[model samples]
Target: MFNVSDGVPAGGEPVAVTFAAVFVALFVAHQVGDHWIQTQHQASHKGDAGWSGRWACVKHVLTYCATAMVSLAGLAAVTGWCPDGVPAVVGMAVSGVSHFVIDRRWPLRWLADRLGKCPDWLERGGGLYALDQSAHIGFLFIAALVMAS
Candidate 1:
């Protein structure tokens, strides 16, 4: 877990500013890793079956999680304060697994198809991408909370 200490008087409760900073850091990490760091092959092949797709997704998520960890480390170095616990690890595990599942797109696609008469947007690949990213952002928030807690 990433520890984000805000130089607050140790032994006392943390300040809101610390959490806010961590949240911003994690969010930035998400954007950087998910968009900038990810390669075309990783983006397009994450949902493939067998080892190829699974490996791609794993690599992507590792980079994504590393981004978040580095961001938190940066914040800690600069602020000299951070949350103290395993929250970040737990959060990352949850987020990573969630990301892997969502990126697969099959489950969501199945649901959309089952619900028949779905909106055109929901049926498009772009919509799935949007949904996948939204889920990631949501998990990022959770990760931040884990760090802040």
Candidate 2:
């Protein structure tokens, strides 16, 4: 899956494939993460009242946008789309692992600690949030390879 030549157009720029992969992966990540938070953890609205809750949601969305931008920048660097010749496998591995560690595990733990709760839906196996997160990471890794190639 990491093979660049597999998906890249012969002698053409590889930006489109890479961009698509990133977008898809990020969407998957959000779906899985949001589902986990909603079903399992009970969406913790940080503020009181409808307006406040909406504001909080907006803030959360902004945070996610920032994360996506940073991930893309890092991915571009690791893929050597700038420097060139960097090992695609290494780039994929790094991005995947970092996302798993930082986004899922760490944030879940932190939110649980701060909010005084863990995802109850996760215990029920309603939609396989764990698998979703894993798949999201895997997709990002594959996307990185496709882009790099």
Candidate 3:
């Protein structure tokens, strides 16, 4: 949960600006983590049906979170902005859990199916990745808002 606060913190960045920056940081980190940082093995296998797939997803998520942490810290250092501890932790947990759930892959497919998206479309093309990344971005918005608070 986010606590209400003045738009500007000690660093003097308004909440709107901070939220935008935090969202950008999270989004960029997400792209890098999911694309560049993720191992080919993880990408290929994380969605498989087994403990192995679970392990790969877990490993990928760990690195993804690390990249996000580094990105946020770097942003803070460069901008002199700081997030509160509780909200920051809550936000990260939210983001991390959401990422893990989404990367498990089946959840998104199931969701897409339930929502009436074509199953073959998800299987054959960029549909799954699009849904996956969009979910991540949606959660990132929540994370950024909480952190900015």
What is the alpha-carbon lDDT of model 1 when measured against the actual structure?
0.76
Q: Which ten residues in a row have the lowest lDDT in candidate 1?
A: 1-10
RMSD of 2: 12.1
lDDT of 3 by residue, 14-53 (tens): 6788899888989999999999999999999888889999
Candidate number achieving the greatest lDDT relative to the actual structure: 3
Candidate 3 Cα errors over 4 Å, as ranges: 1-8
Question: How many clashing pairs in candidate 1?
Answer: 7
Which residue ranges in model 1 land beyond 4 Å of their true spot?
1-15, 111-119, 123-125
How would the candidate models be sorted by TM-score, starting from the highest? 3, 1, 2
Give the Cα lDDT of each candidate: 0.76, 0.48, 0.87
Stretches of model 2 off by over 4 angstroms after superposition: 1-12, 24-42, 46-49, 81-149
Which candidate wins on TM-score? 3
Candidates sorted by lDDT, descending order? 3, 1, 2
Note the residue pairs that clash in candidate 3.
none
lDDT score at residue 120, model 3, on the 0-100 scale: 83
Model 2 lDDT, residue 140, Cα: 61
